[model samples]
Target: MRTAYGVETVRATERQLMARLPEGTLMQRAAAGLAVASADLLGRVYGSRVVLLVGSGDNGGDALYAGARLARRGAGVTALLLAPERAHAGGLAALRRAGGTTVHSPAGGRAAGATEGAADRPAGGSASDPAERPAGGPAGPTAAEVLIERADLVLDGIVGIGGKGGLRPDAARLAEAAERSRAAVIAVDLPSGVDADTGQVHGAAIRADLTVTFGTHKPGLLIDPARDFAGTVRLVDIGLDLPEEPALEALQHADVARLLPVPGPESDKYRRGVVGIAAGSARYPGAAVLAVAGALHGGAGAVRYVGPAGDAVLARFPETLVSDLGPAKAGRVQSWVVGPGAGDDAATVAQVLEADVPVLIDADGLRLADRDTVRARTALTLMTPHAGEAAALLGVARAEVEGARLSAVRELAARYRATVLLKGSTTLVAAEEGAVRVNATGTSWLATAGSGDVLSGLAGSLLAAGLPARDAGSVAAYLHGLAGRYAADGAPVGAQDVAKAIARAWRDVRD
Candidate 1:
């Protein structure tokens, strides 16, 4: 599992490490890593042009020092100081000594890169949108514009992890220009203008080709919105002893492989656990078919399906044991999966809730199940809801739930006394307490019809196999995401394709 820490914890750890080292030892260590990462991206550094968007913090100092290293290695490096008076004194002098120059980008300075009465120089491209071609400044091309246009690399040090409230106007403009430029933008630590603790991005933020973070991964680097801005993240160890508990965690292949339930010599169909799938209706038999399709591949020994779509399910997967009766008469099952497309079947949902087995509720079940009764259940209850369903359960707007997905999942899990899985661009599984697991796998193509139904059956089977509510939900999501990726190798795919790919994903993880 990959773990990520929040801002306060990261800061405390850094302070301790800094105290033991020399005055600038930690900074130098970080600078060395940053410089190395930058050099690798630049490839041929001899005549490469590098631009550093310097701010008023150690983040900027790290960039300046790294720029000095590049200058020494025969690269033309320039520092665009957003605040010259507050810039790191040591770093500024080091740059000058290494034949690099610094220019103050005062708020009201002419758009053109000029020295007033000083020597005339070309300007880099004035800040603009990253997606467009480099547009010349109003007064033709300025020195700043020219530098940015010709630069092979740009380092973003505008805001550090400690900063708050999104981007200031000037910072936003520069970030936009850097992104618009042809250079590969590299962010120091986390991306600028992002909430390091919450993974929230507001106003304008730097979109880097890569982010060189120090010591450990920050929460923002792992979560979305901010995570989207942080293209690819590379962690550099500056040697800080961190705590075991992280603000967030992501399961890797090894973690999932260990949790997978494999058949053994002593195991029989009954010993392996039977998953009871109560889904679909007269109107939508496809929901039952898709759900059963997923269950067959989810490590379950047998699936006892009780619903209106028995004929459709048996047609696609004859392995499924179909019954026309309700969940109460579905015989014995280790776990029950209620909802999916059982539209208006409040009575069926109520019956499954009383089954005394771990139950996974999704789709219509989320809408039909009584909140008070669900909370009263003794066994593990896993609720999988997309943003819309989750919002209704929490009695809030969909936007509210989506804006703070981490908080929403936790809140729903705590209130309902169940494990909650919020599915979206960034799928999260949260228990009533502890750190949430952010799904590391998936493709946008997974957002098709009946996809959630497929996920419900897979997760329910894991629950039947004796995985706890949290593990079952998270593991299912991880495999589901990988399956989505495999099924849609860049093209659109249906729920059946994702279901078919689940076995491939499971085996790939084991191998």
Candidate 2:
């Protein structure tokens, strides 16, 4: 599992580490890692021109120190101090000691390198000094912009954990210039202007080609928006003694593989686990067929279909035991999957919920059930609601759910007292206990009608196969998403195709 700690959590960890280490030890570790990464991006530090956008916090300090390192290694490094007077004293001294030049406003530009009288002034040095003063509107294009445009690489140290939402005027302008430049951008820690906890872009954020984070990963680096801006992420250990809660998580293929049910040789069909599926009706029997198709490929030993569409299910999957007595009489099952083309049938949904086994509620089931009853369930329950359905369940607008997916999923889980899977551009699975997992795979093409039905059945089957409610939900999502990608193979695919692709996905994962 890959972990992502929140900003506050990271700060706490930083504090703990600070207590044991030297005063500037963490910053030095961060700077050294950043310098090494910047060097890698430049290919060769020798003769390379590097620009450092220095802000007023530790972020700027990191850039300045890293620039110092590069300068000592034969690189031409320049520091564009946005707040020279407030800059980290140690970092500034290091940069100057290592032969890195500093640039200030036009009045102080000549000392850096500007004509006597130009619109763009050179930065650095004293504006009061007549010999160093430039006759220009200001400094030429701002030292940061000028150096960023000409340099081979740009280091963004504008904001750090201490910084708040959005960029200040100077930082924003510098970021814009860096974006337009040919120089590769390397962000220290996170890309500035992104909410480290929610992955929301506060304002214009620096889009980095790579971000070198220290100690652990930040939530924003693992999620979207901020994740998109953070092209690639690398972690640098700073030896922080953080607590467990600080280690937020993201699952990898190996982690999913471990959670998947692998049938043993001695396991019989009934011994493995049976899934009871209450889905579809005469009007929409295809939903039942699709659901069964997914259940068939899931790790479940058997699937029992109980609904008005049993005939269609039997015709499509003869292996499924067809029963008309409803979910109550569906016989013994380790888990039950409700909804998915059941078409607002409250009675059928109620019967499924009344079952003793763990249940997965989806589609119309999400709409037809009583919220309190779902919360009262003794067995494990998983609610999979797409944005629109989730919006209804939460009594909010669909746009609200889509806008803040993480919060929506968590709310749904807490409200239902079940594992909630909020399916969307970023599928989020949140447990009632507050554990959240984000699915990073799958193409946009997976958004076809009835695709969710397949996911519901797949998750239900995993539950029957004995994985915990949270694990089953997350693993099923991973499989379903992978299957969608495989089914599409770049083209549009239907829900049935996605169902068929689940078998292939299972093989891919198991093999």
Candidate 3:
């Protein structure tokens, strides 16, 4: 499992490490990593045009130091100072000593870069002083903007994890110019203007090509909105001794393989556990068929399905023990999967909640089931809701749920008193307690119709095989996402196709 900590926890660890180490040791380590990564990205350090957006913080120090290393290696480096006087004093001196030049994104500018923090002058520089001139240098901040536009790489140190809210007008304008540049933008730790604790992007923010985080992973790098702004993430270990518990976790292939249920020599059809699926209807018989298709691949020994689409389900999986007598008379099952395509079937949804086995609820089941009734259940209950469904449960707009997916998923789990999975760009599974798991798999093509139905059946089957609600939901999400990616390849795929690819995903994980 890959873990991420919130900004406070990271700060606490940083303080602990800093207290024991010599002054500036941590910064030097961070700078070394950043410089190495910058060089790797540039391929050839010499002759590379590197631009650094220097703010008044340690993050700026990190960028400046890295730029100094590059400058010493024969690269033409320029630092565009957001706070000319307040920039890291040591970092500025080092860059200047390494044949690097400095410019200022001074307040106000021509209408060209004036959207947010527009500078007053053109991209020019004041590097005429013997100690301030860059190699192949141009004069001042006006020239710096053009350097930014023509540079091979741009290091965004405008703001760090501690900074909050949107970008100031001048910063926003620079962010815009950075985007227009063909340079591969690399954020020092995190993109400026994004919340470090929560992955929320309030206003204009730097969208980086790669974010080289120091010490530990930040929660914002793992969650969305902010995560979206953070293109690809690369961790640079500065050796901070963090705590055991994490704020969030992502399951790797090895973790998933360990969680998978494999049949033993003594395994029998009934011994492996049976999954009861209460889904589909006359209106959408395909929902039932697709749900069973997924359940059939789940590690369950047998599947007992109860709903109006009994015939449709059995027609597709011939192995399912189909029943039209509802969940109460669905015989014995280790776990139950409710909702999906069951439109207006509140009674059936209620009956499944009373079962002694673990229950996984989805789709219309989330709408039809009583909130108090689900919370009162003694057995494990897993609720899966997309942003829209989660929004209804939380009494907020869908945009609100999607914007703060981590908070929204945690709230849903706490309020419903069950493990909750909020599906979207990042599939999150949160238990009433413990670190949340973010699904890093899947493709945009997986957003097609009936995908959730397949997810419900697979997770429910895992519950029958005895995984806890949290594990069941997260593992199922992992497999479902991988399957969707495999099935989609580079094109659109139906839910059934995703269902069929579950075994392939399982094989891929185990191998």
- Cα deviation of 436, candidate 3, in Å: 1.0
- Give the per-residue lDDT digits (tens) of candidate 1, residues 1-511: 8888887798788778777777877778888999999999999999999998877677878888899999999999888877665566677767778988775543332211211110011112223312112223546444555666678999987668876656676567767677768999999998888878778776678899999999888888877778888988999999989998888888999999999999899998888889999999999899988888888889889999998899899898999998878888878899999998998988999999999999999999999988899899999999999999999998999987876677788899888888999898778899877458888699999999999989999999999999999899989999999999999999999999999999999999999
Candidate 3 per-residue lDDT over residues 460-479, each given as its tens digit: 88999999999999899999
What C-alpha lDDT values do all the predictions have?
A: 0.83, 0.79, 0.85
The prediction achieving the highest TM-score against the true structure is 3
Candidate with maximal lDDT: 3
Question: Which candidate would rank higher by lDDT, 1 or 2?
Answer: 1
lDDT of 2 by residue, 276-301 (tens): 98999888888888888888888789
Separate clash counts for every candidate: 15, 9, 20
Instruction: Arrange candidates by TM-score, descending.
Output: 3, 1, 2
Candidates 1 and 3, the one with greater TM-score: 3
List the RMSD of every prediction in angstroms. Answer: 6.4, 6.3, 4.9
